[model samples]
Target: MSGPRTIWRSIATGLGALALLVCAASANTASAQAPPPDIGFDQNLGAQLPLDLKFQDENGETVELKSYFGKKPVVLMPVYYKCPMLCGLELNGLVRCLRGLNMSIGMTAEKDFEILTYSIDHREKPALATQKRRQYLAAYDCPAANDGWHFLTGDEESIKKLNEVIGFRTQYDEITGQYAHAAGLVVCTPDGMLSRYLYGVEFEPKDLRLAVVESSEGKVGGLSEHILLYCFRYDPASGKYGLAIMNFLRAGGVLTLLILGTAITMMLRKERGMMESHRLLEGSTHG
Candidate 1:
């Protein structure tokens, strides 16, 4: 027994030494690597937007960010036209989700929503924005796409300020001459308050539509969506809405009770109507 114990102790000591060596090597490798991108999605939900900044639209006309606010919620995306990889993936994902929504873009439809995309690359010109818009709008191919989607460009200061409010981060890679960014979109309320955030390259249509509906504060979606809100709640860490088991159970129970009560009332009314009809028939016969 003592010999076996001594052997086990020796093995443990060796394993601990090996783990320390591996950790030291990993630290050295990390230090040698180009610093990891500072880009990521931070969920700053329910924050008020900074709408005072200025940006230029696709047509080269300067526009106030606040002008896009009011009356309808906005699906906001920060991307640069020249990005070699991640930005295109983000846009493609966004368009895919948009195609799934029956709702149109622009405030002309009370139930519709809008998309506001701005480039973080301060040096990008309006021509690039215009070109990007035309390409996407053609792909979207809806008559209302003309009015629904807007591409914007702005100076570095304005871009930084807006991104700061949304907690979106991006960094330029000096070695690669490209921008590094995470994939996500922000939804702002009709009055320009940050409402929902969705992360990743592929967004679920249900998630996208529900996010827009919530941000609109029931001004856009029907009663069904409002009912769904009762069962499903937003999850901050995952950046998606998930099921609320207890709330769902409670809602189901109440609906069942209401249905049973209505059935009983209907039966009572039918029984009373039959009795009155029978009494009237007997009285007529005796007369």
Candidate 2:
């Protein structure tokens, strides 16, 4: 597995692939809009989002951050609508994974989640956002997603604040006239709390399901679904999911506690039944 420190600039020739180009920016040549050297994600778990911040949705209606909450876990994705290569590939990877899942975006089931794609580039307009949403939805073939999925555009100030809260760092490249940002999804809870972040463009359905379920605090799925969480964990270094050694060690203790609780409940119930029977017999003798 490669380290997350891997950084470079590339141009997407088409939807199929991205051509990596090693272009270094000189200090004098750097654009004022260019981001710092740290163009990546720093996951802040359980971070409370600024629900008061505002944005324009795809329909050109202004809404607060709170509008998207209180229903289901949200998958927050920050992208530029006009991004030539990287953003499209990221969206393509996401749509492919979503298409594979049995759970639809807008419907409630054992597994349900919301998606928020915010344009980090403040220059993007609602019209561009709507167009991008139309393109992705039409390509995805999931009409239900039109309701659950959201594409938002905000001012530079709002975008900056939201980026600080999520620690999503991105920089613009003066040479390429594109923004250099990391690719990942932040899984947030219903109350607008950051829960987990899964990196990279390609995502596994199992990982996505687990992330949604875990972010909801097991509110959406059953106990059986949690078995995977006990074994697997998100590895930031590799930007992938792998075995959880600590959880594996604690599972035995948790199972033992559950078994002990059940046995204690049964014993108390038996004793109570016996006492009731004795009282009835004594009353009958007195009569």
Candidate 2's residue-wise lDDT over 120-172, tens digit each? 99899999999998888876676656687889999999999999999899887
* Winning candidate number (TM-score): 1
TM-score of each model, in listed order: 0.80, 0.70
Report how far residue 106 has shifted in candidate 2, in Å.
11
Worst 10 residues of 1 by lDDT: 102-111
Can you write out model 1's per-residue Cα lDDT over 1-287, one digit (the tens) per residue? 99999999999999999999999999999899976779877877878887888999999999998888898888898899999888888888877776666444332222377789999999998999999998887766566556878999999999998888899888888888788788888888989999999888778777877788898888887777778788888887888899999999999999999999999999999999999999999999999
Model 2 ranges off by over 4 Å: 1-36, 103-111, 245-287
Question: Residue-pair clashes per candidate, as listed?
Answer: 0, 1
RMSD of each: 5.0, 14.0
Candidates' C-alpha lDDT: 0.84, 0.82
What residue pairs clash in candidate 1, if any at all? none
